[model samples]
Target chain A: MRICIMGGCGHFHTALKPDIELAGVCLTGEETPGFSFLINRFGKVPVFPSYEEMLKECMPDLVVIDGLFGHHADMAVCALERGIHVYCEKPMAINEEQYKRLKNAYKASNAQIAAMLTSRYEPCFYTLYKRVRERTIGNIKLINAQKSYIFGERPQFYAHPEQYGNTFMWVGIHSVDLILWLTNSSIVDSHYFPSGKNSFGFEGLDESAVAILKLQNGVLATVTVDFLRDEDADTHGDDRIRVVGDKGILEVKDERLYLFKDGEEQELELSDAPDIFLDFIENLDDKGKRLADDEAAFLSTEAVVNITGV
Target chain B: MRICIMGGCGHFHTALKPDIELAGVCLTGEETPGFSFLINRFGKVPVFPSYEEMLKECMPDLVVIDGLFGHHADMAVCALERGIHVYCEKPMAINEEQYKRLKNAYKASNAQIAAMLTSRYEPCFYTLYKRVRERTIGNIKLINAQKSYIFGERPQFYAHPEQYGNTFMWVGIHSVDLILWLTNSSIVDSHYFPSGKNSFGFEGLDESAVAILKLQNGVLATVTVDFLRDEDADTHGDDRIRVVGDKGILEVKDERLYLFKDGEEQELELSDAPDIFLDFIENLDDKGKRLADDEAAFLSTEAVVNITGV
Candidate 1:
């Protein structure tokens, strides 16, 4: 089956392409860029100048859209309208209007679609979601999470509002999706405050934004998404979630889960994301079951839009 | 030294009076009437019918003000004007004007004074503070902290708008103070959102509020303070702070400090809380070196008042 991958010129493709067979990778950039070196190292794969050209030539069975967060909805809609399954990335769009259009397209097409909230596929979150469902922590009441980084210039999204929108919508939405998915809750009220702006000799966008989400069950969560720190410290990237329930507290940070059970603490080993895309390929083959579903990803992105007032 | 302790007929006195040489204690039996066991246990400490009567009679050395968060500032000022020192509970007042008055009175008087942000005195926070300063976590870049509980009965102060002009000032300020002190950074910018009325049905009181603070030198922090979760959970009662720095991320929740270092995670033994009054007592003897100087505490309170827009 021929596969056409959009947004192939980006770093995501640099990681995702090796996991699956790509009949053709499309980019707005002409001249196949650095893929020749990749082809020399791996194997030969065809490259197309644009997504439209690739779609026409390959007639691909699946179209994976790995474009910027703000462009995913439109590209996914285009793919769905053509009756092609789509694997889009998180923060599917800038606002609810885009999400609404995407939802309409999905309904109209009955297309197999998925979103890449790769963090959900992480072992730590997967286990927490399971335990919370099994009532291991007993009636989850609150979820507090953080996804912060000293984003350097390497991720060009921070420098392009047209691509990342804001730190909250770009990287922060991962925690937003993971928390809601883990607790099986939906946001009822939400707000965001942009902290450090672009004046610090930093690149494009607000340096960071703080968001508060009140879930339907009255569980309150505050998530801070930032791009203002220095990335010299590897263990210092703040990616964590803490759920407070009637019985105890369940926290997953970095690569471990701490269960505050009966006044004692216990640690459990969790995945450290050695091969993040491996799960995506497995799920794509399974029609993306047990991974972050399209609806869940959409709601999380919707929360980001609401908070950022985008 | 003589003393006048308010809320004298209640459980607080039961916890505090053992360490206090209370010459007088004031009680207002307005709700369910307070217990008289204090008079039975420590007969030497007179039980006054009211604050006025106690003030007219005892003229004590210190006013141990344990009133609600809203009223403590006003009562502390009144005590200070009469040349009495004040040792009050968290959130000395509910607005900047009142906080200014409290600060002014402390300055005008020749008496020793302090506000009880007792969580700062908690062993876990002390350990975390020392360790961070000692470079256990290296130079900090981000902090996420919280203190919340299941909303109890509408606080007496909530009913009196003259006192608690804002809910964020009443409850959220402590979490604000904690994050500021833990990171040891000054504010650059902040934004907050209130979560409607208290879920426990406190009139005019916000159920919760969340804020994002940008610290000088580019570190960012977020804090959530609420009274909207079950208090039984281990993560539900005390304050929690996570500081991500250049070397490591240190998390202090209640009485435990969880440290992430060199690809391994472990809990550290924290310190013990002494009589918070001892700090003021030492400062009184030296006229310097207080745990939290009035100016510093006032600055934190001002940051909170400004963020909540009270």
Candidate 2:
């Protein structure tokens, strides 16, 4: 089963590299960051100049897309058209039309698909996920989460939501995926409130926003997503989430799991988390049951691109 | 100067006990829990059998309304009509009509008033408040705060929204006060999303809810308020807040102030927090300058009472 890579946009495809080398890999038409890493190590831009050419020759079992944000859906749909599995960076689609097309192709083909929602596989989140499933905190009543990133040097594509999409879809989707994965709840209703003031001079960039989600099982959650972190911030991203339950509370921050139980703040040992990319490879045939809902990634992206801001 | 006590529903009025004993307190019409405390101590259900009688005789310099949650407004209004100061337990008014009357009376009088918004005076929050004023976390971007309470035995009034009010206003009011007080920003637009489901057993009880506040200075905040805490939980209430700004981040919880700056989490030495009741007593002449916005409290309660639920 051949695995193929496409596009040079982001480093998400790097997750597939070690596995790609170990199992033998094929390069599709685009010159991606992964391509250079492979070329500098193995010598040569390693041929196949296009997606159609790669598909005709390689007939790869999977396609990993790390392309322009807007191009992910069409690329995934192209793979799905031939029943190839896709391990694409979020989101698989940027618009309702694009999502619908990808959904159609995915349903019609016998293919496995995944959005790169890797946060849930982090050791801290994984430990929390196990504890949540174990009812460590009891019935979840509310959740408050944050994902903040610095506005350090963006690729020119970011200036256009049509190409890069807004930070709500680009960055916020990770939390959207993890919260759903951990809570095992569906979003009955969600609203994205964008702060339109601070865009750092990019007229189309949505620098800050919040997502309010009402889960079907009576859980209320608010996700604060922003690219407003100051350059002086020590880290490029700040991720934190606190889950409050009827029994107690649990928090995941700075690679640590904190349990606030019986008024005690205990930092619990983290659970070992599986590499998402390796897990995807190992469970290729299990289909949708294995991955954080790729469709959620698509749906959220579609919802935010045409955001009804408040 | 005299401090007269009114009815007692909750134990918050206990904060005034020492001062009341030292400063010579008076008791007005109606039997309150405080009346029992004073009577049990002084060997009598002391004096006045009516508010008017107490006003005429005691001419109390201030009134502390710790009556039925619904009667707070009328109680405050009565004192305001006579230019007497009031330190009322929250929702100075429950409905718009009540708030309008309270506002009218307040505007026409020289009375100093404060809501029992005591959480902002906690050492952790007070410390964060100082740093915010000092511009420690420069240019606020967003805020996430929580106030969770256990559904311990509630008063008979809990079954009546008309009397007890929803938890959104009753409990969430604390966070509204603190978030606004710390940010030093006015609420530009606000919304209350009540998860009108988990009401334990009382149909009228708002067991869980979230308040989304858009501040005037581009601060986005969400307040999660609930009465879904399990009885076995350690504390009666779990209060927490995280303020993120362009410069750094700060959190207040568990009686400690945590600052996340330059990727380092530091538990900072807390600043001295003035006793809220003591501060109010000392600064009665300062009017609205000292207390967390009493109007924000009233406005929030008023807005939520007539909530347009989603």
Candidate 3:
């Protein structure tokens, strides 16, 4: 099967680096960092001049869509209409209208799709998921997650809400996706609080934001995201989640899982993580059982769009 | 100064274990833990028959009120009306009506008052506050706190909402007061979520709860509280707070302050912390310069009542 990458604007394309073979590559006509990453890793693969031209001529069996945030939905729709599988970056669409169009196309297509919600595929989180599935922490009642990112260099597209979407979709979507995936619950109630007070000179960015969501499965969850970490911090992102169950507690911090149970705190060993790109490709054979499958992508994006309304 | 303690139910009476003269003591017609604590620590102080008698006959200059959750407000009011300074366990009031009554009595009296918000007086938190006040972390942008406690032994009053109040007022108020004290910001918007599904056989208790508040200073803050911590865990309470500013981050986890700044994570030395009860006593002469003064207690309790409505 031929695999093509559209818009080297996010790490989604890197999923192709480990195992899959790339048919073609498309850049957003700028030297975005993601393109540099592709160049550094794959070293000058085939390039497509424009996204539309590639969709018309180089339509491969699958298209990994990244690039500017607003353009992702239309690109996915274009690929899906041709019965092509689409694996896109976070926030499948910037608004409900775009999401609706993509949804209609996805329904009619004889293809599989997914978002690059790779957190579920990380070794630490994967292990945590496995333990929770094993009832190590029984009956998740409350969950709190935090994602802190350094305000590193950004592409020019981020200055426009139309191009980059809002910060909730860009940064906060990760936690929302993780929580929804773990709980497997529908949002019954929610409150969205965003402040663009310290926007770090970006017009559409909220440097600090938080949301509280009550799910149908008797879970109260919270997400706090910020882009105010010092740029020179150790890692680009600091992620944490604490799940409190009636029986035990599980926490993940800095890519490590800490379990508090049996009256002792233990750092559990990580499970082997599968390649994200391979996971998506394998989902074609095992449709509903895929990790972070189509439903998760759509639901998480829809939730973010509803929360941010951008 | 003559100091008396009323209603031995919480740890507030323990403050008298050090450097203070206990003029008298009163218990709420039961062998509550506070009375046992006074007996074990001070070998029994001057015992009064009832709270009213303590106010009228003993008439100590200051009173430390800690008893049934709902009874704290009226006890404080009684003491404040007699011009007796008060250092009470949180929250000062459970409902707005009770808070209003306490406020009136406090306004009419010349006595000083404070809550046993000993967290701000602990070495770890006191150092963080001092450094934040010194602008070590720059402008505060967002904050999140977690308080997890065991569903251990409870007094008889906890079985009723009218006597115990809700979990937010009982447990979540600690973090609310801490956030408000640190940011010095009034809440402009807020949302509270509470669930009593697994209340550990208590009627009014919300085993899991969360609240999000947007402060007037453009800071977004959140509080998550749970009575689901495993009963056999290391400590009865596991508390944490993360303060994020534009320039840096300050976090306190399990009584240790972790600072993330200058591209490094450092644990700073803790400063000497003063006794909370003695702080209020000294504030009688120092006036508004107390650590957590009258406004802090009333504002924190008022916020809790508004959020929980119990």
Number of the predicted model whose lDDT against the real structure is largest: 3
Off by over 4 Å in 3: A18-21, A34-46, B18-23, B29-34, B40-49
Give the count of colliding residue pairs in each prediction.
Answer: 1, 2, 0
All candidates: TM-score of chain A: 0.86, 0.88, 0.94
RMSD of each: 5.2, 3.8, 2.1
Residue range B1-310, candidate 2, lDDT tens digits: 4677666665445455443642223342333434566545633334555555565666678877776787888878888888888888886667777778888888889887777777767788888888888988888888888787777776667777788767777787777777767776677776666777636677677778876778788888877887765566667877888888777888877668888776567899987877777777777656455655556556555545554231
**How far in Å is the alpha carbon of A61 misplaced in model 1?**
1.1
What are the TM-scores, per candidate, against the unseen true structure? 0.79, 0.88, 0.95
**On residues A150-169, what C-alpha lDDT tens digit does candidate 2 reach at each position?**
88766667777777767777
Best by TM-score: 3
**Two-way lDDT contest, 2 vs 3, winner:** 3
What is the docking quality class of candidate 3? medium
True contacts kept of each: 0.18, 0.34, 0.70
Q: Candidate 2 has which clashing residue pairs, if any?
A: A8-A32, A29-A50
What TM-score applies to chain A of candidate 1?
Answer: 0.86
Per-residue lDDT of candidate 3, residues B178-230 (tens digit) = 89989988888899899866377766667878989999989998899988888
- Give a tens-digit lDDT track for model 1, residues B54-94: 87788987877766555677778888888887776556666
Model 2 TM-score, all chains together: 0.88
**Residue A188 in candidate 3 has what lDDT?**
81
